[model samples]
Target: MPAVVVVGGQWGDEGKGRIVDLLARKARVVARYSAGNNAGHTIVNELGEFKLHLVPAGIFYPEKTCVIGNGVAIDPEVLLGEISQLASREIDTSKLAVSERAQVVMPWHRLIDRLDEERRGANAIGTTGKGIGPCFTDKVARRGIRIVDLMEPEDLLARMRSVVDYQNAVITGVYGEKPIDFDACFAQYQEYGQRLRPFVQDTQALITEALRSGEHVLLEGAQGSLLDLDHGTYEYVTSSVPSSTAGGATLGVGIGPTDVQRAIGVFKSYCTRVGNGPLPTELFGEIGDRLRDHGKEFGRGEYGTTTGRPRRIGW
Candidate 1:
C-alpha cells in the first residue's frame, strides 16, 4: 500500500506503538498525525525500549523518513529534547521533519494547562499538563505560534507580546496565578526556534510527493478512538481526533482522502483507560485486581507512558 493509517481502536494505550514499530520497517515514510507530547508510545526493539512523545516511532528505522504533521501541537523544547535523547542513544534523527504549519506549544500554555486542571480540582480532565489542549486552543483561536513563526524573531516577539498579555490577564486575574514574563519566555522559545529551524518544512508537500512516488507511508495516531474529541466521551476526551476514519490522519499530513490505501486498527485483548472517564465494561473488585496484577497494569510496573498513571482495566 502507498499509504496506511494505524489508529487505536480502544481507549489510549492500545499497543499501537509496537504495531507501528513493526510496520515502520517496511514503510518509507512514517508520519504522526495528531496530538502532542501529551501522548506517548513505548517501542521495544533490538536498539532497546524507547518512550517516544513528540517524535514518531519509526525513528528506529534509520533510513525511513519520520514526520510530525501540522495537525500536531508541538512543544519545541520537547521535540528538541526527544531529538537530543535519540541522538544520545546513537539514533540518527537526520530523516526527521516537522510541519511548518504545526502549532508551537508555548511555555505559558503548559502553565495555563496546569492551572486550569488545578482549578477543576475533582473534575480535572486528567491531562498530562504538557500544554496539548491549550496549544490546540490557540491554534483554533488563530493566535497560535507555528514552527514557521519561530524563524522570524521579530514577528515571534510581537506575537508573543500580544498573546502573553492576554494570557497573563487570564493567568493572574482569572486563575489567581503569577503572570508569565514576555521577555523571558521569548528569549527561551527563541532559542528553541533556532534549534528546531532545520527540521521545519512543508510536510504536506513532502508526504504528497512521497505517496505519488509509491513510497509506503504510515500515518500514526496517538491516544485512541475513545479519547477522540468528537467521538469520545465528553469533557474527558483528548483535544484531537484519534480515529483513522476521522480524516485527521491524512488531512493533518496534507494528503487527500484517496491517498490512503488502507486503515489498520490496533487493539489489545481487553480494554484499558488512563486518567478519568466512563468505562462501562470496567472490571473492579477482585477480578479487576487480578486482571491488573496479571497484566501488570499498575503504574511504576506498567504505567501510562505520558502520565505514568495506573490504567483502569476492563474485560
Candidate 2:
C-alpha cells in the first residue's frame, strides 16, 4: 500500500490536524515522525474538539494504530496524560506505541529550556517552556536519555544525576539561578518511566512489518515545512524536517523523489507564526486583535504541541 505524508506548508498551525483526522479513515497506521509535544494538531469533529500533542492525530480512529517514531522527543508524563484524556472520551489507545529509540524528555531539560528562554529576554523565541528544544539539544550532543535507558532504573537514576549535576552547575553558577533538586527531578522521571514502560516499542520493526503487510500509512508532522530546520527560514526554524523528505528519512521508508506520486500541502487562509522569526505578513494592533476576537485565535490557551508556546494569530 502507498504511504501518504501530510505536513504544514508554512509555519505551525495550518489545519494539518483536520486533514490527518480525515485521512485516518483510510490509513491502517498514522505515525508521528518527528518533533515533540511542542507542536499540536487540533481536530474538531462530531465526536468533539481535541488537541493532540504527543500521540498521532489518528488516535481518534478506532481501527487505526498510532505510532510515535524514533525521530520524536517524548515526555512520558505528557504522553500518559494524553492517553488518559483520550480514554476519558472512551477512545481506545491500546494500539498506540512509543519507539524504544525515541529520546525521553526529563526534568532538567524543562528547567534549562525555560532558563534559556528567559536569558533571551526581549529577544525571546516564545517557546512553550516544554523542554523540547533542550531535549533535541541533548540528542545532538549525544547525552540524551532514550526510552530504552529508562528500562534500567539504576542507569536512569545515574544518568539523571550526572546530567542534573552538570546542568545545576551551569544554571546556578552561570545563569545565576537556584539549583534544581536532583532527587525531586529523578523521582519525577522515575514515575514517568514506570507509567510509560508499557507503551515503549521497537518502532522500526513494527513499521517494517506493517509496510511488508501492505498496510497504508500516514506520516504526520507537527509543524510546517517553512519551519523545517534545514530548509526553513534560517535560525527561526523548528528543529526537524516537517516535509515529505523528513517522513521518508526518519521512518525508514527510503522513499525517493520519483516515488512521491502525489503530494498536497495545507495552509490556513490567515497567517500565524510563533517564537522568533520573520513573519513578513503578520497582522497586529487592532487589526490583529479583531482576528483574534472574530476568528477566536488568541492566547496561550492554543499552544503549539511541540514548541509549547501560545500561537501568534494573524489574518
lDDT (C-alpha, whole model) for all candidates: 0.85, 0.75
lDDT of 1 by residue, 1-315 (tens): 469988898887888898998999899999999999998988888887788898999998889999999888898888898999999999999999999998988888899899999999999988999988888888878889888889889978888876888888888999888888777888988898899988989999999999888899999888888787788887798886334334678777888888988888888888888888899999888877676667752233447899877778887
For model 1, the superposed segments whose C-alpha errors exceed 4 Å read 241-246, 296-301
lDDT of 2 by residue, 11-92 (tens): 8777788788888888898888887888777777778877788789888888888999888888888899999999999999
Best by lDDT: 1
Model 1 clash count equals 0
Which candidate number has the best TM-score?
A: 1
True lDDT of residue 114, candidate 1: 92
Query: In model 1, what lDDT does residue 42 have?
Result: 87
